[model samples]
Target: MLSRTADHLYWMSRYTERAENTARMLNVSYETSMLPQSASAATKAWQSVLSISELLPAYYQRHDEVTLEGVLHFMVRDETNSSSIYSCLQAARENARAVRGALTTEAWETQNLTWLDMNRLFKAKKFETDPAKFFEWVKYRSHLSRGVALGTMLQDDAFRFLRLGTFIERADNTARLLDVRFHAIKNDYHGTVPGKGQAQFDFYHWSAILRSVSAFEVYRKVYRNVITPERVAEMLILRRDMPRSLHASMYEVVQILEAVANDHSAETQRQAGLLLAELQYGRIDELLATGLHAYLVHFLERVHALGGRIGSDFLATADM
Candidate 1:
């Protein structure tokens, strides 16, 4: 496959996943921010979403008060925000157009229609009626696009690249959520500083975390109980059985990266191999023992660095 095609496929998948995770993140914040205990916490919760998308500073530079109105506007409607609903759909469409021959007619139509709907929804200002509904619609469309891609595309290098992008984005997003929750309200030996075991505490935040990943219902089904901090953390960050977990997503990313790089350059293979070893040998018990926040920040930073390595390894090319 052409490197350009591979790049498009990878980013197409990443942007779609980014859009979905962003929606879930905001949706959970909406639900959490309304709770009496969580009132006034929207800025912190939503700031992390912007941060994860690398848009925090940009948004702050342009405006003040990361309020629900400001952040939501940026996240949902800001064309400049690549992680916004509109930008992601536009990027997905551009990628679909780039690799038109590699995609099925159904796949192309689905992507195009998805983009059209997102554009129309943003234009209609229907998100004001009920932003939650609009975000849910975006998430559903993302799922539909994924389904069509999986159901229609061949299980070839292109597909592998798409899966690679998705799982990595998920892993990165999960790590960010964990970092925010563990750091934003953690109790500790430090003096009673701000955000130290606030009114909502980890318990309330756990629900937010669970909801952010769309794992609340599935988590309850699996564990069959109310949300717990440790269980939610373990399920999201460490559980191998759960597809959305950091561990599971990391596992998929490394595997798909390996598969995509296997027949290519030795450097790519070696990078993937190094990443795989980190995942395989790095024990979750060690992370849990170290305290979740400390471990998660380190893990997220490592993932970010790995993404840099990936870009340098196979995706980096100069414009002609």
Candidate 2:
């Protein structure tokens, strides 16, 4: 296969995961932001999320209003927004098209249909009148796409690369979610409730996080208590068994990278191994000691930098 072919396959997987995770997160944040907020608090929450995703600057440049409508317009409807739902789905479909032969019919069809559905939704007024339903459709499609890929795709190099993309993307998103949750907890916990958000940590917010990975019931089974901010953040970020948790996703990514780069040079192996080591050995106690927000921000930076390194050495060839 050509380097470009592998690159496309890799990114096809990444973009699909990115689109799904983005929709899930935005849906949750949308609910959280809708809860009783001061005039500027919703904007502040959205800004924090956008900043964590590294999309705030792009959003600000394109939109004048920081209101819910303006930010959602930029993030949900704008074609120029790379991290937007539209752009991610479009990129995923393009890559899927480029490697149609390498992917199963189901994979291609799933992506293609989802893309079309999203386009239609954007054109319809339902998004304005029934925003919840619009987002629900996106989230539902994202889950369907993942299920088709998992059930129908082959488990070879292509599959491993695809898994690698999804795992890494999930880890990155988990970090972003944690950063937002931690900051919100810290800021709001002190206001009216001790160690809880000013407004009861909002069941809607926890449901959003749980719903992101479709793990709301799983959280209930594991914790068996009403969702609290600290536990939600912990479950989202630290739980090793949760598929969308940072630790689980990072572990999967490391294993897949090791499997794919089995013949890599010692230096490459050492770098990836070291990073994986840090992630595995980390203790939530230690992180909480230092502060979860600070740890997550730094951890995300490390993961992003590691992604750049992987691209340079393994995913893409360097000029000699």
Candidate 3:
């Protein structure tokens, strides 16, 4: 494949995955804010959404404060925010267009139709009136796009690159979600134990966090108990069986990297392997003992660096 073609295919999938995950994150904040809480707590929930996206400073540059309406507009439609769902879908469409010959017809149409529908929603101001429905639409479209690609595309390097982009983006998003959600739960827990005053209050928040990643039911099945912070963290961070968990994402990433290995990708493969191994053997108790935030920050840095390495090796483009 041409370097430029590979880059477009890779980013096309990344942006689509990003659009879906952004919807997931925003849905969490939107739902959690409706729960009974102080005005400040509601504001903080919105702030956490921006923080997880690492767009907090960019957000403040365009707005005075983090209001629900402001965040919805900024994250859902702002063209200037390149990571917004609008921008992500737009970019995904453009990239898919650039490499249409490399994509199956269903894949291309899925990307194109998603962009068209999103524009209609923007014109109708659906996000303003019904953000949750709009978010579900985005997630549904993303699922369709992925399913189309997996079902129709040949299992070639193009497919491998596509999977690579999805898992890398997913791994990064899951880590960020875990870190931000963990801190929010910690603040609400206030060193309180389960079955106490704050327990019920914390339950809703914890449930929101799991639902953000679509892991709530998986948590129920795996633990078959009340949602505790420790177990939630364990399931999301370590459980390879949970589809959205860090370990599961990394598992896919490592396998994809090995499948698509090249002469230049050895270092990238080594780094990816090391990260996957850490998640593979890592324990929740040890992660908490050292500080989850610190560990996650380090993981983010390494993942970002790994992304750069993958770019240099395969895409021949800078990490976007």
Candidate 4:
């Protein structure tokens, strides 16, 4: 495949996954903000969403306060915010269009139509009145696009590139969500005993995290124990069976890289393999001993480095 085509295919998948993940983050924050909490706590919850999304710097430049209204607009519809759902969907559609011949008819149509529907909805200001519904629509469209590609596209280098993009984005988003939420909760409970109010707050907070990743039922089925920060981290970070787990994402990335290894350099494969190995063999106890926040920050840096290597090795072109 031409480098340009490969680049477009890879980024199209990444942008679609990013849109859905952004929705997931927003939905979790919105739901948690509705829970009983002090004003300061609520503000912290909203701020954490921006921090996890890595949008705080840009957000502060545009808005004076962290009001829900301002955050929602900045995250959902702000065209200037490159990582916003609106921008991601637009980028996805454009990338898909650039390589329409590489995509199945269903895949291309799904992406194109998603972009069109999003524009119409944004212009109608539907999200201002029903933010949850708007977010759900974004996730549904992303899933539909994925299903179309999987069900119709050929399992070839193009397909491998698409899968690579999806898993890489997924791994990054999962790590950020876990790290930010854990850090926030740890700060709130600074060695204090679980008072009735604190315990109640912790329960709801952890439940929101699980629901954000669609892992609440999986948590119940696998652990059958109370939700603690340690177990939640274990499930989301190390459990290979969990589809959105960091381990699973890394595993998928390595496997896809292997399939497409004929043309790429070995460094991309090595980075992915090392990360997957750590996730598979490393214990949660050891991770906590080193400080989970510190570990997660290191993991995120490695993931970002691997992504850059992949682009340089496989997708970078003179024109691009």
List ranges where model 3 is wrong by over 4 Å.
188-196
lDDT of each residue in 194-226, candidate 2, tens digit only: 454634656665576677667899889999998
What is candidate 4's lDDT per residue for 248-267, written digit by digit as tens?
99999999988888555688
The 10-residue segment of model 4 with minimum total lDDT is 311-320
On the 0 to 100 scale, the lDDT of residue 85 in model 1 is 79
TM-score of each: 0.87, 0.88, 0.97, 0.96
The model with the greater TM-score, 2 or 3, is 3
Tens-digit lDDT track for model 1 on 209-259?
Answer: 877777878898889976666677778866778778877887787677767
lDDT for each candidate structure = 0.75, 0.74, 0.90, 0.90
lDDT of 3 at 50: 91
Q: For candidate 3, lDDT tens digit of each residue in 1-320? A: 67788899999999999999999988888888887878877888888899899999999999998899999889989999999999999999999999999998889999999999999888998888899999999999999998999999999989988988998899899999988878876775466554665777778888988998898888888899998889988998898999988899889989988998888888888998999999999999999999999999999999999989889988859778
For candidate 2, the TM-score is: 0.88
Better of 1 and 2 by TM-score: 2
Question: How does candidate 2 score on lDDT?
Answer: 0.74
